[model samples]
Target chain A: MNFEFTEEQLMIQQAARDYAQRELIKDVLERDAKAEFPADHIRNIAGLGFMGMMVDPKYDGSGMDTISYVLAMEELSKIDASVSVIVSVNNSLVCYGLEKFGTEEQKQKYLRPLASGKKIGAFLLSEPEAGSDATSQRTLAEDKGDYYLVNGTKNWITNANSASTYILIAQTHPDKKHKGINALIVDKDTPGISLGPHEDKMGMRSSDTHSVMFTDVKIPKANRIGDDGFGFKFAMQALEAGRIGIASQALGLASGALERSIAYSKERKAFGTIIANHQSVAFKLAEMAVKVENARNLCLKAAWLKDNHLSFGIASAMAKQYAADIAMEVTTEAVQIHGGYGYVKEYHVERLMREAKLTQIYEGTSEIQKIVISRDLLK
Target chain B: MKILVLIGNVPDTTTKVKFNADKTAFDANGVQWIINPWDELALTRALELKETADSCIESIVVANVGRVETESTLRKALAVGADEAIRVDADPKDAFYVASQLAQVAIGFDLIFAGIEASDYNGAAVGGMLAELLAIQSVSAVSGIQLENGSLKINREIDGGSQTLAMNLPLLAIVQKGIAKEPRIPAMRGIMMARSKKLTVATPIEVEPLTSILSFELPAPKASCKLVAEDQAKELIRLLHEEAKVL
Candidate 1:
């Protein structure tokens, strides 16, 4: 029943807020226009230990709780989602997977650097043919006596240009179907690994996303996570944890838009007085506030469940679906509230609106999340 | 050398000011609290000075004069790399009261830092009073400090320019902006370690306040701007000259 955050959590939130408002907001518009990656900012945040906010301290992480991670994500996402996505992937997918499943030796060599943010990591699951249907992975990892030979095309791979380590999911036995998949950690400097051109994305353009082609890439067998054919369950569990991060990002977008709309409405005058004095604009702001609050509650609930080691799959799915949808709705209303100014990049509502669309499309699409939730409820 | 940074707890800069019923106090409901901007910068500079290998800074301690709720602000100072905190359990009624309370715990520190003024009141008096109370030399409007050859090098903003001075230890520096480039954000490690950092609460000696506020009033709302058509240059000039009275 306690809603108040701990002193540490509040301080972390403030730190993230201060960094985003002071540092990230400085070049966000220019970065978005140029579609440039935030390399320096990434190093700076990693120095701040945001890249592995929830990893164990023994492995060079901050050893923070999931709730603190959610709070930091929300604050950072308020100004720049591109940066937040990198943080999310490294913490939830890369570091969490390694810490939870990797062998002691694997943790010592690979997880240490990744969790310390000395190196960045990426998760490769989706392909051209397998978007929502993850079981239809066409990428194959052939079993060899000493090592596994990996060959696959991973699409929409985030941090493709900058990451040094990748947690790759590929099929090892086609007859075993979904049970045949394995998740392996591969060094990006390995031979026969090439990356396609950075995709020109609609929003979050500052985030580096590309298609990675692996041609007979040799990976150590010791790098495989969990038992044989455990990659599917590992990826699913990681995604369940990752949904909290995305949900918080969406919440940030929604709340950021609402705040801008409120500020703009009070200052912007229309026919006779400020638009905020009008009932129409005021009601829209009220509705946006409600949506943002609900989204925040849902995000926090999912994060809390995860932190408590409770079953958070269904909760996270619901949060991701609701928050992403509401982010789009709220950002659109924020733009409408700004009148003609919302169409441009100056006031920042337009950029927030653009960023909101990706939250619904990435991680797990809204349709897929609905499937997860409905399936869980029926079962 | 041990450093003591005088921390001030203040409302966030973006807070919308609201008065209590009788207009004597600020409304605290929903107001977010933060470390004073200048004080944060002062702490940042202290940390930067400590980073040098040759510097003899042993630890940085932040002291505040406030109630229990101000512990969060003090904890934040710790999370930003201060070694420990000392809170004078009392209401910071006035600059004199605050300086008087701080002087007790601040006696042993080799170097002390005080922001020129708290953002809320802008009293601009605590640093000078503390120096007088402790009978130590004080520098005002200090914008920079560096440790050079075991001596303190200070850069202070003066009328129309700046001046650099070489000073000794056991001095109170009333710092202004440019003390550091930016306030340091607490890293995740610092946040975790802050929980275990020692925050000592000292009992405050009774002190009589030299000033009290009877009421508070906000400045009048700005008049709406009268925009003249771009083509009517003469009209705009006339309005500016007559109404604004700046010509």
Candidate 2:
């Protein structure tokens, strides 16, 4: 099989890189410093058709391949990881889930707007008690004839305040454990639904993150994502897609850090020679390059498998784990290469390092990804 | 009404170039390609025209003269709003060959559009040659185009400003950047539709080349900027006259 990217993929990658450099990089540091959500940046990205890179055309999506989507994410993250996460959650976690599991009417109504970028989407599966064990969620959706009364709290959710629709998971029958979990779509403005105070984050602060509380929220039964007990399955599928996005994010952050390190090392002189001319500094750059390249390759392979409808669950997990670890390693090394300058905010490596940490924590923790890969391997 | 857009897959402008050791050709390694940015402007105008008419323009057909490697560019044109694509499967070393190949496939179209020049070659000759071969009225460096009652109204850039011209149907125009902002990235759904859209490849008629590349090289490095003291305006002017020789 040919591994080279098609011309279209290359174009998307180049366009994303160009857009990121020209549009996103200028204010990334200032926005990160102030913990401001880049609302206008998101609008620009939406205008570029990235908010729905994989959704079908009928809904006004870009309908690009999975790899193209990942490439776009990677390029965007390279300039600013915070913005990348916003796009990732919207396209992979929320829209992909709705398109795959929702009914025809659901696709027409919810998926169309979300895919078209006319509305933002958020996925709410993590609760205070159910961060990793999603089936043990405390949120409940009690049946009330034509509607379900949803009452619960989801914490640390991305895009909670700005999202127009939320794909929320709650227990419809708590006695049945995992069998009772169900996915439901809730409009952000539905009565009894309100956003919690925005979180003060260390990195990716340009993307708003907040808690969501649903108290006696009434949603029509038609809003159910899939069969009654398929919420966990839907969440898992979404997470699988989300892993690719996270991998791309890791790749982007790492590549950006590496690029900065290389440039700095070449420009800075030490002991009458460029730091890059020293074996110690040169070796670090080389290692970072190796990790970034390997991580990118893994991400591309996983995304390709997913796009082709092949078995990619295990591959996705592996890619996510490798990329996350690589991002952390490369960014840390990038900071080290900067020496004292890296500690300062003006240098930017410190910010990249902070951004790299989140990739290992969200989507799936590095530890969680390892477990997933091991389980798949055993199977 | 159907409109045909001729696109060229040219090397991305930001890419670094290298020439062969013997200087007869340029190295192709690590070269990235993109749809000529100017053609994207033309395509956008066509889409805008189609959108405003309230009647779906029958189709926007992109015709290219290249190999299968060019399919991606064709797909992009489709994604950006073209309905189908046709490839004249030949390299076409010169503009006449490309023009003749396009003339063969451009029949039954109300207008033919192209970029002023491919970013790779910067020849800027294909549009004129195609117009000559097809015996149609031609306009080059079009910054704007409008369709009305089977005629094309075009605004083209001249030396310092722009000139507007109108031509009947079955005309040719080569677009320039001042036409419009680069076309927006195709939407997700448009990309999906492009996957199944019709793209036909046909053998191209052979035409002889008139000129070939002899060599390529980087331009000379710029001289270092010299700093002149604020009080030495006279010296700066002397330097400009004596050293830089601009005065």
Candidate 3:
């Protein structure tokens, strides 16, 4: 197999790099300090057609390849994971799910706008107790001849406050367990929808996170993504690719951390010599490079599989688990390499270290990823 | 008006320079390739001109002289709004070869734009040479550009100031910064559609080489600075005279 990226993929990577360096980096420190969402950045990303990167061109998306999406994700995450997560949720979770399973009506209304970045989309699955266990979904949606009354509280929801559309997974028949669930596209303006206090997050502060509560929210039957009992399977399928997005983000964070560490080692001096000349500092940088490269290979392989329409669930899970683990490890080491300077927010390693932790916990937790891998492995 | 944008490939600005043991050539092991920044600036300006003055311009095409690898760079030009691209399949040895190959494909274009210099070699000769080869009016180091009734008004950066020049169509300009604020990044949709766009890959016409390289060398590594007490003006002066040879 050719390991080289195609011409289109490389261009997308460069675009993301330029956007991140020019536009995103300028406000990252201030945004993180003030916990601002940078709504304007979302508009800019949409204008660049990044939100609909992999959507079909007919639907107002760029109809790009999955490899391009991964490349863009990597570059965007290298500078600001807070912004990258917004992209991830839109491209990987909401857009992919709707496009894969959405009917003509669903695709026409929600998927189009979400893909074009005219509106923001959020994935609603996790509840207070259902973080990794899909079978424990507590959200309820009662069948109402022509509509469903949806009521649930989804926490740790990215883009919760500002999202116009939500792809929510709720139980229609609790007795049937996972088989009873259904995924619905709910508009934010629907009655009985409200938001809780924004989560006081430690990292990715530029992303708006909150607990979205729905009390007697009514949505037409047309909003159902597929037939009844498709919610659980839909979430599983979406996360398989969503994992790749997270993996790429992790790889980008690791790469950025390694790059910063290399620069710091070259400039900072100790004992009349540059720190990079020291064996210990050099080895740390080496290890960081190794981890970043390994994670990148795993992510690209998984993306390639998905792009070619092959079996990618196992590869995606493996990439997610490995990349997230290394991202956390690398960023932590990057901070260590930075010494006391890294501990402060000004050095940026501390922020990256914090950003790295979310990849391990979200999309699918490391433990959940292990479960996915172990199940596939044993079979 | 039809526009032809001259695109080139150069090593990324950040690639670390590492020479082989004999120092004959650089190791390409991890060197990343990117569109030359100057060419990119020129391409962006041309595309912007087309976008704003769509009624005046008919189409824009990009041309490059490199092997299959450079097709990727040219594809980027297409994604950035070039109507099509023409790539001459050969390694460009020098500005003369590059200019000759470009002039062959650029025959019918009403306007031509290129960056003032490629970042790799800093050889700022390609545009002027191409203009001379094609027997067209040439402008160098252009910045601000505007189109009027079937003609153009452009700013040329001169020594310590900028000058405005009015020229008609079939004009060739080699541009520097201020031609465009920042090079436009190709939107994701543009990139997705770039693959199937009309990219005409033509074989290069043979031409005699004008220059050859002997060997490459990097400047010496910077030496550490010396700190002197505030009262040591005489010592500083003496050191500047003897060590720096600047007195």
Candidate 4:
């Protein structure tokens, strides 16, 4: 009903914007260039409550509304998508999933630390053989009395090397396919779990991503999330929430790119006047603004639906698809506006372009989102 | 030791001040409110004291005077790490009125903290008035405070420098910037916990504003700086001595 932000939400948004502009923006270029994670900045964000924006009060969370979470994500992604993902995965993917599905004991042991920003969390679903076809996973979990022996390799896992806890998806019964999928909470220090070398990424290099290999890793049965067959459902539900986060991140990246493009167009001179005076440059900036605004609206609508306990799966998927595509378009146009300067890393549009590409691929790929939308429409 | 912090919700410092058409009062149409910066220092220091001494400290209670807007600020105080918050629900228009309301609620607290001055009115009268009403020892402009047994060791600014004084428990102190840690952002978890924390709002006794607003206006523009030629050093010195009278 109310489209405008609440006073608390506005305050938090302003705080995030102020903090990002003051602390993150200054070093974002350097960190992206050198592929260095800003550990201190991450600590500062944790100190500011960005790390656990939606966590429940009992576990030391901000217990903020979902819209506030999206707002914070949008602000962070506007500065650097890599940092946003690190925060998003910790808040939405790992922590939210556990809190929603974990038992009291599990919450006390796993959710508390992650929600408190004391540890990092990762969602491990994609494997080399099963990227979109998550049900065809080769990873297996075998029940052995009190423990489940897990053995599988998950690739493209975000925060693999740094995460203290991972919500890992594996097959409990290979013959049952999707119905056999199960979610397991695995600690980073488990004996048979080893992290592969960090992936050499093209964008979002500040976010550490790699492969995780489990060689007969023994996990307590208590760590199993929900029922044995509910892993796929839980993973899908978590991704639905994650799609909204990605959409907000896309909106943020586009917004940042568009803002810079506008500022530059107005400042750069051509034919004895500012380039912004040219219809060509002016139209491009206008179009970029339109796309960013549309994407932001969609992201907000999806987040609002989820917060109100409505069925937002289709809306979330649609928003993700539209926002991701728009981000790519806006970032690419932003670079074009910079012309020769945009090609070089010195200008940041090139980095924005690179960052925008990942949003189309992660959470759910643009293609996967279409499938989700079409399937929902057909039903 | 029990510490009490007095919080206030003042117009956000960033908001431009405006006046009503009749010129009788300031326009508050779109003004945003925030926890007074000075009171944040008080709240932070009280929380710090509780953290360091653990069980030796009994509780950290925050008190405020205003409407529901004060509730959010109080929640923020709690999230920043206070144990509880109490709102004296009345819009006291002047320092003395607010202090009178707080004086009625100052019982059982060993140490009390408030901002040296509120940002909205810039009135530095609440601490002294509250102290006088409660008949307790008080100190203002306190830059540092520590608890020792049953007394408070206070470091305060004076005209030329700073001074240190010690007062027994059940005293009042106005906190300044250097008194404690800067306010911390309520983390996701802390924010969630604050929703369920103990926040009590009570009806305050009636009070009247002692001072009324006449009008509001912006401060005069800063005098422009003049560029003095390199060879005019002697002339500049003469101007400073004879014209500007700074000699």
> A357, model 1: CA deviation in Å?
1.5
Candidate 1 lDDT over A62-162, as tens digits, reads 99999999899999999999999999999998899999999999899998999888999999999999988999988999999678998889999999989
What tens-digit string does per-residue lDDT give for candidate 4 at A285-320?
989999998998899999899889899999999999
Order candidates by TM-score, high to low.
1, 3, 2, 4
lDDT for each of the candidates? 0.93, 0.87, 0.90, 0.86
DockQ of each: 0.88, 0.30, 0.75, 0.28
Q: Write the per-residue lDDT of candidate 1 for residues B16-69, one digit (tens) a residue.
A: 899999999889899999999999999999998888832588899999999999
**Candidate 3 regions with alpha-carbon error over 4 angstroms:** B17-30
- Between candidates 1 and 3, the one scoring higher on DockQ is 1
Clashes of each: 0, 9, 0, 9
Interface RMSD of each: 0.7, 3.1, 1.1, 3.0
Worst 10 residues of 1 chain A by lDDT: A143-152
Q: TM for chain B in all models?
A: 0.94, 0.90, 0.95, 0.87
Residue A296, model 4: lDDT of 88
Tell me candidate 4's interface RMSD: 3.0
| Number of the predicted model whose TM-score against the real structure is largest | 1
Model 4 stretches with alpha carbons more than 4 Å out = A4-34, A38-65, A78-80, A99-118, A133-152, A170-182, A214-231, A254-293, A328-354, B22-24, B132-135, B188-210, B220-247
Model 2 chain A: which ten-residue window has the lowest total lDDT? A6-15
